[model samples]
Target: MNTPVSALMPVGWGILLGLLAQSASAGFIDNSSATLTARNFYLDRDYKGESPYPAAREWAQGFILKASSGFTEGTVGFGLDATGLLGLKLDSSPDRTATQLLSYNPVTREARDEYSELGITFKAKVSKSKLSIGTQFPSLPVITASPARLLPQSFRGAYLISDEWDGVTIHVGRMDRVNLRDSTDYGPIGLASPNGRFRPGATSERFDFYGGEYRPATNLTLRLLRAELDDIYTQDFLGVLHLAPMGEGTFKSDIRVFNSREDGRAKAGSIDNLNVGGMFSYRWGAHSLGVGHMRQFGDSAFPYIAGGEPAVLSDGTMSADFVNPGERTWAVRYDYDFAGVGIPGLTGMMRYLHGDSIDLPALGGRDLKESSKDFELAYVIQSGPAKDLVFRVREAFYRNQQDAGSTFRSDNETRINIDYTLKIW
Candidate 1:
């Protein structure tokens, strides 16, 4: 396959890749591997309050093929990677659409019967540093891909990583387009807003970021990052993760902070936000207990990419982000590993979150509050024919006390996924 961005990328980078490719050796193909994962996913959502669409339920099958080639044997090596995805709808209707399992069918006001996507990445490595161009899957505090539905989100960009520094890693990227989890085409990036969609004319063609992670000790990690969505907003993030021994158990602490402001022309309109949150958990044998808290302070809500996953805070759950102007959230959770009870490969989790003090002056705000209850159970086959097969069930009960006239409604959501992977060499 040809490199999709070979002609669009800068000449200097192209020269480097050309040189590396010319030196290709046996390692380029010897260490290659491919895997295909088959996923059966179903989602059901029931609206709680007054709404035209009462429910949205859909089921689909997805196929994802990931193939990667090893770098050539040299100080400067080259490689390529590709991901192919296909989604087939099994059950859907026009009345009960918008389940995010497939693309929208405007003609029938229903979900499409099928959709597909392809992504390619060209890479070159020099010593311990590597640079990738074309498609990216970033999981960072500033920008991340959302994989909540039948297929995962994707972005077109260039990413670089360097790990030559002792105990430190550096990340830099320039993303230009985004494909939402439910979409098949990549397009301009937009800012996520308080009301669940991007404002009119609020879009950017590029996203730039630089970040680094440091590990000063075996049990501690620190990360700092700065990112900008051109003409829209700029955001900064700092996070700390630590682990300690606590009375026969281990205590884990996670703290994250985000500061955002309008950038350039401020297409998102005068962004100002500070999002602070953390999740702390203690584990003993097979039981884990955790507590989390997140709060948004400033004139505007938290800043994030539309349809992107910002998992920096514990409140970023299946149904709600708990991110609004003056919103503060508190959560508690419990988890158990069934292995302690003789059922290896099984796990369960329960969590509850309460959010209040929302500021929505436009809707009279009116003591705005929201709450969510979540449960998850997962199991994986340990041995036998289904060795690596996985089964997962997730449910969320969410409600908000928004204004009566508001279209936002309380929701009951359920998701089930069964997955199996096959290896091909």
Candidate 2:
């Protein structure tokens, strides 16, 4: 396999992997799981303004292989996990390149036909705690992997998670390098664009974070997290979730808040931001209704992993995230469960979000606004020969307050996805 990125294994990784080879070859084989998934993804976008040679569209096929070994029998258990990813471009051209489905050639301005990536993690378990060293796919409030594309992003480093006490979980880790969602190369962490686009500059090699979650009650969860991207920025997060039974329905509330500031040396410049958001929902039978609100404060935009999808406050889907400097957003959504109507494998969702008070210092201190309407329909095979086969279609219409000549204009995006997984244990 010709992998796009070469891994520089750390010292601890070498030692742990050697131990895994010995144990996993014998005791660990008793309990192990292996799976492979095939994903076919296609995307198309219609620009409202002048297009980059017209609308951008692309299609790609992906294969993901995952293998995990059970822990060796002992007080100090050991195991190994591996992930292999491959993406092949099915339809793409120079005029329809750079849709983030595949890597693009700079000179030719064309997407590559194929790309691959591999990652491994060696784990040690003791009691309720586990430590992993090597590449990882993390999903946390402060940092997360972008799995919305053909290939998900990965981080190269170590992670430690423990749940020694009842109803409480602790997490600590550091990621020095990141493999972006599209490209097959590892690079430093950076800041994300307000519009969820890619941007260059303001990067850091060390991204250190530690956090914990506490569930004091069966229906309540609280989280606190802190992180620092060395020389770039520091961030703190707080989140709360609650669920209550209301008649035959359920009422849910989720709140998230973040505080960020420039770190020592301020490589990403003077950064300051406070993001707060919440979602309230009521679900009864086949129908669910939700409303959300979010606000951004400070002179700078919300800081997150650049070129990657971090689940910031009120950002759940891939279509759009209402996060801009000094921005305020409100959203309403509806969901239907086809299972309640005898369609056991289908579901649909629709949402609309409106945001205003966008501050663009780069565009001469101008303020703008944006809104997005999104819809999705999904289905999955429940059983039989095609069990677990899944299909989904998502569409979004986004309009921003930017001028027509601006690079960020109104556009419509649509994506179609099909996936199937096979177990090889």
Estimate TM-scores for all models: 0.94, 0.93
Clash pairs detected, candidate 1 = none
Tell me how far the alpha carbon of residue 96 in candidate 1 is from the true structure, in angstroms, after superposition.
1.7
What's the CA RMSD for each of the models?
A: 3.1, 3.7
Candidate 2: C-alpha lDDT: 0.82
Which tens-of-lDDT digit does each residue in 1-425 have in candidate 1? Answer: 12233345674356446646564567787878999999999998898877777888889999989999888777778788899999999998888887778888767877777899999887888989998888788988888887777888889988899999999999998888999888889989888764632355588888999989999999999999999999999999999999999998999999999999899988778788899999999999999999988888888878888876566565347766778778899989999999999999999999999989988766556358888999999999999988999999999998988754443458899999999999988
Best by TM-score: 1
Model 1 residue 363 lDDT score: 54
- Give stretches of model 1 more than 4 Å off: 1-24, 194-198, 364-366, 404-408
> Which candidate leads in lDDT?
1
Model 2 spans with C-alpha error above 4 angstroms: 1-21, 24-27, 51-53, 194-200, 404-408
| Cα deviation of 360, candidate 1, in Å | 1.5
